[model samples]
Target: MSSTTSRRTNPVDIIVALIGAAMFGLVLYLRSIEVSWYPVLLLVAAYLVFAYLFFRRQGGFGGVANPKDFYTGIVLLAVCGVFAAGMFDLPLGRVARPGVAFFPLMLLVLLFIFAVAILLSGLRNRGEALGPVPWRGLFIITGITVFFGATIKGLGFVPAIFVTGFVSCLASQKWTALSATTTAIVLTIFSWLIFIWGLGLPIALCGSWLRTALVALGVAGESIPFCY
Candidate 1:
């Protein structure tokens, strides 16, 4: 092999490998402070595995021939790393009963497996060139998420989901005002029935803020819609 032969390392893979290395270092530092968690061990093992792959030039780290799978793998690997870290805070209970993070951790594991499979495919099969990102859809979805989170408590689930559904429908650029409004109404009603009536969950239809604002404008409690 010529010394001048350029290595075709994927930038995405390099980024992921670097992240894993950083995480490994962080976990070690955490352990130094007595934050010895189970996920920390798993993450250490994961980091070592990636470091092995990265150095050996296996799993597309040698050269990413399939950019699409490489990038998708990077995204999923990032997701798994983030959520897996969060699992450190939750207790992994026994078989008779599961902790809050048990199911989520299991799901993350499954996601990680899938991500690994997708990554391995890059070593054999070549995928089509990646397309331009759907910025419009991404922006709309991100805005919707932010709105839902910000308003779910203050605006209440009913109005928040309704507005979310409504805006979501309109985001397609094909939904008319009437169509979006109708879909929002149906979505809101069905969700309310399933979550509130059927499950008997303690989600409020309207929040106290709405009632206070309405009352400030001279609307009585009896006149407020679903605020009682």
Candidate 2:
């Protein structure tokens, strides 16, 4: 491929690829870290950055936003920060299984309340203007992420990629078996090399029990005993 042939692709494509590379790299770096809250922080930051980028790409942040989105985001940020802090701080007696779970629950509640408030306020204010959400794209993206997160460890990269990409393509109404299969394989290889070899992150490529054992050992070996 000539340099001019490569240059035919837009800068946006390059930027997006770099973002994905950085994110995957960060995930590996994060896995190596001792802190539990780093994932939460990374997730929150990713959401914020993506949200801002989406709005910017769409021209602006929705409509004449007085304090709805900003206020909700700020409140949720505080809630997420608190829960993240609690879950990560071992001496605080907050366990991950339950403590980390509350943040999503809180988010659901906040989302519900925010939606109701926005609806009522819009009704009272008479006129309202907001950009249409790309529901199809959002649903596909979310489904893919959930599928990957849930199945990555147990299924490893291959099956997880197939499942996630196929299901996501189905959700997005662009189901193509060949395309999905090819994409999944490519992604799995990319992820494996990047996570396992490039960054040295510990993800289970072995069987479930062995993986669990290894992870437990890793955690145990990495942990420092607390002294009162």
**Highest lDDT among the candidates is held by which one?**
1
The alpha-carbon lDDT assigned to residue 15 of candidate 1 equals 67
**Which segments of candidate 1 are over 4 A away from where they belong?**
1-64, 76-126, 221-225
lDDT (Cα, tens digit) per residue for candidate 1, span 69-184: 76777899999999987787787654346557656755665566556645644543544556688777788888998998887778787889899998888568587999999999
Candidate 1 structure, TM-score to reference: 0.50
Put down candidate 2 lDDT per residue, 90-209, tens digits, no spaces: 431133333444445335334433333332232222232334778888988897898778777775655666567666766656668888777777777787789767986666554353
Which lDDT values do the candidates have, in the order given?
A: 0.67, 0.50
Counted clashes in each candidate structure: 0, 0
Global lDDT of model 1: 0.67
Candidate 1 lDDT score at position 72: 74
